[model samples]
Target chain A: MNSELPFLVELIVSAFILTGAGFAVIGALGLARMPDFYMRVHLPTAGTTLGVGCTLIASVIYFSFSLQTLSLHEFLISMFLFITAPVSSHMMAKVALHTGVRYVSHTQGRPWPSRTQRPSRDNSQILTEWPKRP
Target chain B: MLRIAVIIAMLMFTVSVLLNLYRMVRGPDLADRILTLDSLYVNAIAMIILLGIFLGSTLFFEAAMLIAMMGFVGTVAVCKYLLRGNIIE
Candidate 1:
């Protein structure tokens, strides 16, 4: 068909789409398979960032070449996803910590304050940032 | 060539969504379920974008953008609710 895309363009677009979908699938698999909440939290970043990034690029190429006009608007969604994914993951991880979700026993180093040293509700006693041990 | 590729991509995305669903349903904790939900929405976005490419429609872009915004807000609100009993507080 005369209207079809050239072979090289088709190949490139296909490659991009496949790569994106592959990353997304792996990310989802990681989410399902990770042993702990923290590990699960780290998994979906692959999907939200590189996965979406590659797919959006493919869409840009398809629409731009097929329509014979530039279509940069898709970047808006990609950028939004990039910004939001980390922030959401961070929030989720923080909540996980606050809730005392189980962690791997062999995890190295202490990050958050130990559960026994709960911070007081009094505003005057609370530090601006990291809590200090009494 | 492109058509076949789009089909395969769609299948892969569907599998990912199903995996997310499995995690959401089998969660050992509330936070784990919510995190799966987060991944679910992102996977959904990928699916919609793939569909748009297959159908050659620009209309899907708006839907994808809206989903991204709403999904982020929903996740943040839920996480806040988990951290603090009240979302507004």
Candidate 2:
């Protein structure tokens, strides 16, 4: 199998795979190391977007070359991932907001609106007040 | 070179899965656990794709697609439940 693949194609595929893997590792590292839920929530987008994208691109290139036919099916997974990852993350963020998950001290603006506070016509006043530290 | 790259990628993905597991277990909040599970499935898809490439087969794409669909639905469902206290309303 190795001998049949052209040297350049192998190099390209290897590079893509390694790049994707690297992004996934970095994203996971951020997830593990981040100090708060809000900060951690932002990290996985890196893995879901570029990391999966590179791997699928490598797959498309490798299969298309080796099979002598255009292999475009991998794009389906990529498209689905692109569409769904953000939606899932957004929903998760909403969950975090509704549940009032704790955030680090430095985060600007109130992380979650208080349930007792009525929606005011002028929202600027809400943003102007710093949250009291517990 | 491709073979070595696949091995290294597999190892990296394994590490990623482990790290996600750590976050899921140690996360102080429910949202954190749900978020970790979401990324964990994505990492699993990546690993499956790598395995398919290593074996020189196209069969795994279907499984990966199914996982992608199911993972998204599951994440959304859990998030909705957490947000609204009900899966369907």
lDDT for residue B33 in candidate 1, whole number 0-100? 85
Considering every candidate listed, which one attains the maximal lDDT?
2
What TM-score fits each model?
0.88, 0.89
- Model 2, position A32: C-alpha lDDT score: 97
**Interface Cα RMSD for all candidates?**
1.8, 1.0
TM-score of 2: 0.89
Location of the lowest summed lDDT over 10 successive residues in candidate 2 chain A = A114-123
| DockQ scores of all models, one per candidate | 0.68, 0.73
CAPRI-style docking class of model 1 based on DockQ: medium
Query: In model 2, which runs have C-alpha deviations exceeding 4 angstroms?
Result: A114-134
